[model samples]
Target: MLQLLRKIAFPFSLIYLLIITVRNYFYDIGVFKSKTPNTPTICIGNLSVGGTGKTPMIEYVIRLLETRKLAMLSRGYKRKSVGFQLGNEESTVLDLGDEPYQIQQKFPTKSIAVDANRLNGIAQLEQLIKPAVILLDDAFQHRKVNPHLSILLTSYACLYPRDWYLPTGNLRDSKREARRAQLIIVTKCPTNLSEEDKVAITRQIKPKIHQKVLFTSLDYAEKFKDDLGQTVDDILFQDKQIAVVTGIASPEPFIQHLAALNLNFEHLEFSDHHHFTATELKRINGFDVVITTEKDFVRLNGKVDSLYYLEVAHKFSEKDKSVLKETLESVF
Candidate 1:
């Protein structure tokens, strides 16, 4: 039924394509100007709407630039606050959005800000803290502030070339815009992806000569941890009935990980950045144990009892790591 509706929406997708193409053309011809920020900025974004593993890739970049004074800027999707807001110790999910709030919590000392206007956000970040480098979260389409380095991400399962515009498929921008990126990372890949598969994906993408392609997979932690830093053994989970709760763009890989561990649990999935109401909270509270993604844990930590979140990080092969180091170094 969903596939049928998507097929029916093909005409709408064409309209979207025309609109985006015109917008890019304007930017290309200098009718729409792109300003470069004073601070060196890196953009990690995807062509698809969701499920592209962007946040994890941003975290990976953060680790790479840990030696420098860093700040992150985001649009704060679904956040209640408006205008430019800088994250502080008192910031919550409502102030900075889930992804930024999660990042703030992980790197407590780093500066995080959110604004609809990328230029304003970058200016405010520079004026206040003067970070050595700024990481722009999900700003590939925001051509207003031209980033020094742009890293494009595509899911191993759903590459941009195979996708169409919104309503019909997940792509929010044209696949041709991918050429603007200096590095293209294939996220959510199989850990054991063979060289043949890598060559095939590169051939399909047909990247420009200046662009480099890298592959990365998710590494889920064996144990689950709660807000208080209490952890439960992975094997002990078999003794109780568990519920897998997630409010993320893609939960399939997380679910598959649990299933591969031979665990039995019912899944309670929600939309990306979904807010839980009283009724939804009641339904979630019925489970003996609730395991959720680290992103969702920020919202449900105090709201739900017996709640635990599984940690996930980007995993790159040694070869890819070296290539990533070289590519990032070249940016500076």
Candidate 2:
């Protein structure tokens, strides 16, 4: 039924493509104005609706620029609060959204703010914290604020070139808009991807001369941590009645990682950023061990007593690592 519906939606996808093409053209030709921030800004986003691993890439860049005073601005997708809400000691997931709240928990010292308006978010962050650089989360298609540098993310398994517009496929923006990015990273690749495969993928992407493409693999942590600050290794999962829970856009990679560890568990997957109901929580509580991703853990922590989260980060090859660093340096 879903496949049939998607096939029927192809004409609607064409309509979406036309609408976005005109919108982008207006922005490009200055019929619509875009504001440039006074502070150096870099945007990390994907053309697709979700599942490009933007959060992990943002965290990776945050770690790379540890010496700088950083502020991150997000649209705060699906959060309860409205207007510009800045992360503080009292900020909750309801106020800043799951991804921003997770980032705030991980890096409490850095400034994190969310507003549907990217320009207003940047201005509030500047007025409040005066950060050296601002990282715009999931704002590649947001043409209202022209970023100084933009990094576009595309998954190795599902490249944007092969995707169609929304309701039929995952792409939310036109593929031609990818040219705006200064750097493009292929996320969620296998660690053992060969050089020939790299060349093939880059050739397939056909990035412009100014744009550099890099590959990254998801590096899961060896140990898992729970809400009480307790850590456990994968060996311990062999004896436990495990339930692997995930509320993320891409859970297959995470599930495969556990399978690679040779662990036994029941998989309980949900839509990305799903808010669990009381009945669902009770169902999940039946398992002896509930494991999830860090982003999901932020929303599930106090609700699920047996919850534990595994951390994942971006891992690049030595050569790609140097290229990424040099590209970021050039951004400033």
Candidate 3:
């Protein structure tokens, strides 16, 4: 039924997309105009609205450019306040988006800033960090900024050009918008995916010659222990059932990760950045223990009772890094 609605609405969505096309034409013709930085800028974004592994890809880019001072810039959607805020200390998921806060928490020394206006946010960041390179999170659609390198991310599950628009599909913009990018990444690839899979996906995507297409899979952090040195027994989790709560763009990866551990769970899904209440806590009381992703942990900072966040890290294979390095070196 949902698929049927998506197919039906696609025509309207495509017609609505003409608005974006006309706006882009204005920007291109200098009627709207765009800004370019003298400093290096790399964007990691998807053609779809949600969960093409942008956070993991951003982390992938940051680690690859190890020597350079990297700052992850974002619009900080659904954050409490508007405008530029440095994301190192004194920033919360309530203040910045979950992903930006997550990056700042993991990489404290690296600068992180957020604002809806890409140009304004970049300007504000220049005053403080003077980053060697700026990594724009979900900036593929931000036509106002001319990135040094544009990376278009698509999910292994769904490619945007082939998908329907919002309320029907995950894409915030049209698939043709992807041509503007310098590189394309098919993210959230399954582990042990063969060359046959890559070839099939590449053909399905039908990228341009100018685009450097690559693939990556998410690597999760397993065997989490508490603040204490004691290792949390995996046996206990297998012996007892657990409750998995997540309010994220995609919970599929986390669910699969737990399944790898042979752990049984009852999942509680919430909207992204959902603020929990006392009633929610009473419901959580029925579970043995609660496990969630690190992205959701920030909102749960003061609310922990039996909750434990299963943290994840973005790691690419050595060969994939080599491919990424070779591509970026040509640009930066």
* lDDT, candidate 2, 17-63, per-residue tens: 99999999999999999999999999999999989899999999999
Runs of candidate 2 with Cα error greater than 4 angstroms are none
Q: Relative to the true structure, how large is the alpha-carbon lDDT of every model?
A: 0.90, 0.92, 0.78
Q: How well does each candidate superpose onto the true structure, as a TM-score?
A: 0.98, 0.98, 0.91
Task: For residues 1-332, write the lDDT of model 1, one tens digit per residue.
Answer: 99999999999999999999999999999999999987989998988888888777778888888887999999999999999999999898999999999999888888989999999999998999999989999999999889999999999989998888988999999999999999999989999999999999999999999999999999998788987978887776777888899999889999999898888899999999999998999889998888899999988989998898888999999888888877776656
Indicate whether candidate 1 or candidate 3 has the larger lDDT.
1
Write the candidate numbers in order of decreasing lDDT: 2, 1, 3
Prediction 1 global C-alpha lDDT: 0.90
Question: Clashes per prediction?
Answer: 0, 0, 1
Identify the superior model by lDDT, candidate 1 or candidate 2: 2
In candidate 2 the C-alpha lDDT for residue 52 amounts to 83
Candidate 3 lDDT (Cα, 0 to 1): 0.78
| Candidate achieving the largest lDDT | 2
